[model samples]
Target chain A: MTQKYYAQIYVTLRPSVLDPAGVAVRSGVQQMGYDNVEQVRIGKYIEVTLNANSEDEAKTQLDRICDLLLANPVIETYRFDLTTVSSEVQTS
Target chain B: MTQKYYAQIYVTLRPSVLDPAGVAVRSGVQQMGYDNVEQVRIGKYIEVTLNANSEDEAKTQLDRICDLLLANPVIETYRFDLTTVSSEVQTS
Candidate 1:
């Protein structure tokens, strides 16, 4: 039987990578008088729902998708959390 | 006293909002033979480091920022997690 899984993936720039967006945000914060703001990094958050035979398959699929398309391996790193959707929602 | 804090903000289209990017991702998943994939919502993940007097202050500042500039109140909803930076990291 297949189960529905939900994954939340966060893709962020490596510490060494130049984050122009982050810099702009930092500047904005400083301009707004939030003088203590620093090292602001902007990233992408993707939420995917899919079906698979098991947790391992769900994770494998998501990992493949992230590595191939969702994240840039040279400058960005990604992490994700996969959760099994309970049937209670299906009944509701 | 001010302490350094980090926030991870996830901005996503509301359930009622139309998500064209999500539609394209869904189509891509279907083409890739992931027939079970659904609701591929795309969003922005922002990481910010700043100084705040307390955890409550941190949340308030972030919430205000999200409402004012980070997220589009018309179509997107946002949530965030705030964590304090340890002094051990400051020393290291």
Candidate 2:
């Protein structure tokens, strides 16, 4: 039986990698007087909706997607969560 | 009794808003032959590390930060999760 699945993927720079964009945003935030903020790191959040035969299939596909397209393994790491969506949404 | 906390924030465009970037990525993915992919959406993932007296204080600061710096209220919505971090890391 095929089911719809929703995946939320997060891709972040590894701690060793420098993030100039995040630094600029942190500076802006600090200038606004939120000085208690020690560090800020910015990354990518992606949402993917797809159909698969099983949770295992979805997870496998997601892993392949992330590795091939979503993240650069050298400087960034990625993680994702998958949830079952209403399979009947498009049928009727 | 200030403690260290880590906050992960996600900022995403509202469903009604159009996402050309996401569309482009989806097209790329489909070209890569992942035809089962139905849709793709992209957003920002931010990590903030801060010090606060209590969880309530941390939550308050996070909300204010999101409202003022991390997210644009016009087209995007933001959500965050906070976790306690070891305070001793900085001192040691």
Candidate 3:
């Protein structure tokens, strides 16, 4: 039987990597008077919906997808959460 | 006493809004030969480290930061997870 899955994937730069975007955001927040804000690192949050035969099958597919398309392994790292969803929801 | 807090924020476009980036990603995934992928939506994931007296204070500050700098209320929505971190960790 086919099962539906929804995944929330987080892709982040390795800590050793310099993040110019994060630096810009930190300055912006400091300008807003939120001086307590110390640091900000920005990354990608991707939501994916898909179908598979089993949880393992879904996970394997997702990992491959992340490696191939969603993340660049050189300077970034990625993690994801998968949950089952009702198949009734249309795939749009 | 001051405490250290780490926040993981997710900022995504509202469902009704058009997501050209998502569209592009979905097509790319499909081209990668992942036919089972139904939909793909991309958004921002941010990691923030700050100092607050309490969890409530941290949440309040984070909400304001997200509203004013991280997310656009008109077409985007955001949510976050906040966790306490050891004060010994230096904020770099």
- Which candidate leads in DockQ? 3
TM-score of every candidate: 0.94, 0.92, 0.94
Query: Compared with the true structure, what per-residue lDDT tens digits does model 3 show for residues B1-92?
Result: 98989999999999999899998999998898889999899999999999999999999989999999999999999999999998567567
Candidate 1 colliding pairs, count: 0
Model 2 complex DockQ against the native: 0.83
Candidate 3, residues A1-92, lDDT tens digits: the string is 98889999999999999999999999999999989998999999999999999999999999998999889999999999999998666677
Cα lDDT of model 1 by residue, A43-87, tens digit: 998889888999999988888788877888999999999999986
Ranking by DockQ: 3, 2, 1
Off by over 4 Å in 3: A88-92, B88-92
Q: Is candidate 1 or candidate 2 better by lDDT?
A: 2
Off by over 4 Å in 1: none
Residues B1-92 of candidate 1: C-alpha lDDT, one tens digit per residue: 98989888899988898879878877887787778787788899999988889999889888888887789999899999899988788654
Candidate lDDT scores, in order, read 0.87, 0.92, 0.94
Instruction: State how far residue B78 of model 2 sits from its true place (Å).
Output: 0.2
The Cα error of candidate 2 at residue B9, in Å, is 0.3
**Complex DockQ per candidate:** 0.78, 0.83, 0.87
- The per-residue C-alpha lDDT of model 1 at residue A45 equals 88
Itemize residue pairs with steric clashes in candidate 2: none
